[model samples]
Target: MLSKKIKKLLNRQVNAEFYASNIYLQMCAWAEAEGLDGAAEFFRGHSLEEREHMDKIFNYMAECGAPVTIEEIPKPPSEYDNLMEVLKAAFKHEKKVTAMIKQIAKTAFEKEDYTTFNFIEWFIAEQHEEEVLFGKVLGKAEMLGFTGEPGQTLHIMDSYLKRLAAAH
Candidate 1:
């Protein structure tokens, strides 16, 4: 059986994941509107991935005999100043999520919930990769200066992102 504290935290994670999905979906919408198809596809994919994350925790809670409560997710912003702005927002969100998951991992360790700990280890690694991935995208956006210009470097970056998105 899971402790109330642990179960509560897990339920909160499910809610957080839902919020993340909404955030990514909003980002995807903005990317599409701004003509960043590659970035749009990337975010679109991540939105689904975040929902999967929520489902994973929900299932884990059931497996642990914990009652699950799905909470209401707040709306995320649908606008950004530019591609750079979008990238910054996403990278910041990823870092925040990494911190959140770290805390959950710590609680799992302290509670000796090895099954939970082991399950969250996957999230820990995934967060790291997510941060790194966003960092790389931010770096590219910074390099290109996305100054609302129509240019070769920007096109190259889009193509790169397309290939990157295709891989995932």
Candidate 2:
């Protein structure tokens, strides 16, 4: 059984995941509109992954007999200055999520909720991976020389992202 505080935290995390999904979806739309197909696809896949993350927590709450409340997600920005900007935003969001997950893990430890702590361990590791992936993508984009102009360099970056998405 999850303690009341842990249950509340889990519910908040569920909403956060959903919000992250929407943010990615918005970024995908922006990429698509700018004809950055690879970036669009990458963001779309990440959006789906965020939904999976939310579902994982929801299912865990169900298994633990904790009722969850689904809250309305705020609208995410639909416009980005460039691909680099989008990647930077995503990397920042991932960092925020990592902090939140770490806080939950700390709370679980403090409360002696070993079961929840074990479950959240997966998220802690996942957040690390998420941060690394976004950071790598952002670094690669910078190395590709994104000048916010529609040109060969940008096209190459988009193609690279498509390949990355395919492997993902």
Candidate 3:
């Protein structure tokens, strides 16, 4: 059973995750409009993954006998200056997610909710992978230089997105 406070927090997280999905979807749209098809596809896929993450928590809440309440998701930003700017924003967002997950884990530990803590372990691992993946992309963008040929950048991003899509 989850404590009432924890249950509320988890439900809030569910909404936050939904917001994340929407945010990524908006970014994907912006990428497509900017002619970065690979980035668009990548963000589109990521939005799906975010929905899965939200569902995971929602399911957990239900299984634990807690009521899951979903709130409205806020609108996400629709425009970005360039691919690099969008990617940097993505990296920052992932970092924020990692921090949020850690805070949840800390709370679970403090409350002696071993089951919840264990459950959150999966998210911790997931966030680590997310961070690493975004970090690698950021590193590549840096190497390629933000001012590089847009076509070359798109090709490279397409290759990476293909790999990620295949992995999924």
Candidate 4:
């Protein structure tokens, strides 16, 4: 059983995960429109992963005997100046999510909710991977300046996305 406060917080987290999915999908659309097919595919895959994250939390809530409620997700930006800009935004978003997870973990610890704390350990590990992945993308984009052939960048991005897709 979850305390009322923790339950409410978990519900909010569930909604945030949904919002994350929506935002990534929006990014994918923008990337597709801008002719960055590789980036677009990468974001599309990310959107699917985000949905899985949301379901994970939702299922956890149900398992804990807490009612899961979803809220409306806000619209995400439909365009970016370049691939680097998009990757940078992704890194920032992941950092923010990491902070949110930390807050939840802290609260769980304060309340002595060991089960919730243990559950959140997965997120903590996930955030590290998320940050590193985005950081690498950003780094690659930086190394390959805007003046380079767009096709090459697209190929590189596609390769990364393909690797990710093959993982699951």
Clashing pairs in 4: none
Q: lDDT tens digits, residues 1-168, model 2?
A: 898999999999999999999999999999999988999999999999999999999999999999999998899988788887788889999999999899899999999999999999999999998888887887786787776567887888889889989998
- Cα error, residue 122 of model 1, in Å, equals 0.7
Q: Candidate 3: what lDDT?
A: 0.83
lDDT of 3 by residue, 18-65 (tens): 988998999899978877677788899999999999999999998999
Residue pairs with backbone atoms closer than 3 Å in model 1 (clashes) = none
Choose 1 or 4, whichever is better by TM-score. Answer: 1
What is candidate 1's lDDT per residue for 48-114, written digit by digit as tens? 9999999999998988888888877899989777666777788899998899899889998999988
RMSD of each: 1.6, 1.0, 1.7, 2.2
N/CA/C clash count, model 3: 0
Candidates ranked, most accurate by TM-score first: 2, 1, 3, 4
Backbone clashes in candidate 2 total: 0
TM-score of each model, in listed order: 0.92, 0.96, 0.92, 0.88
Error of 2 at 144 (Å): 2.3
lDDT of 4 by residue, 1-168 (tens): 788878887888888888889888988888888776767878898889889988998999999889987777788887677666677787888888888888888889999999999999899999899988888776666676633245776567656655665563
Pairs that collide, model 2: none
Query: Total clashing residue pairs per candidate?
Result: 0, 0, 0, 0
Task: Give the C-alpha miss distance for residue 69 in model 4, angstroms.
Answer: 1.9
Better of 3 and 4 by TM-score: 3
Per lDDT, the best of the predicted structures is: 2
lDDT (Cα) of model 2: 0.91
